[model samples]
Target: MPRDAEDRRLEPFEWNSEESVRYEVAIEVIGEGVAHYSALLNAAEAAGDEPEAARLRAEIGACVEERYRLRATDHEGVTQVLHKYRALLRAPGDHDA
Candidate 1:
């Protein structure tokens, strides 16, 4: 299936906490790979290399699709985190503690 705009905007949190560092690195690598592939595809097209451009374009498309998929999953994860935190905040005993 195709990805939506929201899927493209989901961002991983920073690595200030040890528990999230690995996820941060993975997200960075996927993001960079997508960027690199996209740049190469554009450069090939600009150079009038139709064949090479087509190949690179396909590769970039695949990378972008994967990125979008990851973004969607991340968005869901973020939503869950927000819900969990909100619930904690609303707990009775935690009101002043």
Candidate 2:
């Protein structure tokens, strides 16, 4: 929600095009943080600093877990959107699509 950022508003439940895109982007950002933290952890481990590496690894694990949660929430959101737009998603002849 910073002023300098382009996509400042958060709308997890808004199914509209722009809001939906932003919500996905937000999840992506968090997911990317997991990679970033893992990279940092790798660097720490390579330096032979066991204490720092252990701490970073723990934080990286937390970040990875959080990203997993975000991904799961995104999956649920996709299911919700699909259900809400079932009529649109359905085939012309098939009742379930």
Candidate 3:
């Protein structure tokens, strides 16, 4: 995996208080990896390194697919959170008249 601006590769997603924030971070990670791999792919092509170019191309594809999957998961996570919040709102409390 290509390093991001922070010189870190994509780490496994950790639970965040905010699903939207986590999604944003995951997207940024994918964007960074794709950008780095794109640069490497270009260089490999320029140098006529077919093998490396092929590998970079594959990596880029995987990154894109992962990003797509992450988006769906993020949406579901947000929906689940909203449902829980709504349930709490509907629940009767001791103070309810």
Ranking of all predicted structures according to lDDT, beginning with the best and ending with the worst: 3, 1, 2
Model 1: lDDT of residue 76: 56
What is candidate 1's lDDT per residue for 3-86, written digit by digit as tens? 787765756654335435544544555555555656666787889989877776676576455545543335454444344434
The TM-score measured for candidate 3 stands at 0.55
- Give candidate 2's TM-score: 0.49
Locate the minimum summed-lDDT window of 10 residues in model 3.
88-97
What tens digits encode model 3's per-residue C-alpha lDDT throughout 2-81?
66643343346656557657557556656766776787789999999999899889877976766555542467744543
Q: Would you list the C-alpha lDDT of every candidate in the order shown? A: 0.53, 0.52, 0.61
Pick the winner on TM-score between candidates 2 and 3: 3
Ranked by TM-score, top first: 3, 2, 1
Give the range of the ten consecutive residues with the poorest summed lDDT in model 1. Answer: 88-97
Better of 1 and 2 by TM-score: 2
CA displacement after TM-score superposition, residue 90 of candidate 3 (Å): 46
Point to the candidate with the largest TM-score. 3
As a whole number from 0 to 100, the lDDT of residue 82 in candidate 1 is: 42
Measured with C-alpha atoms, the lDDT of residue 43 in candidate 2 is 81
Cα distance off (Å), candidate 1, residue 6: 5.6
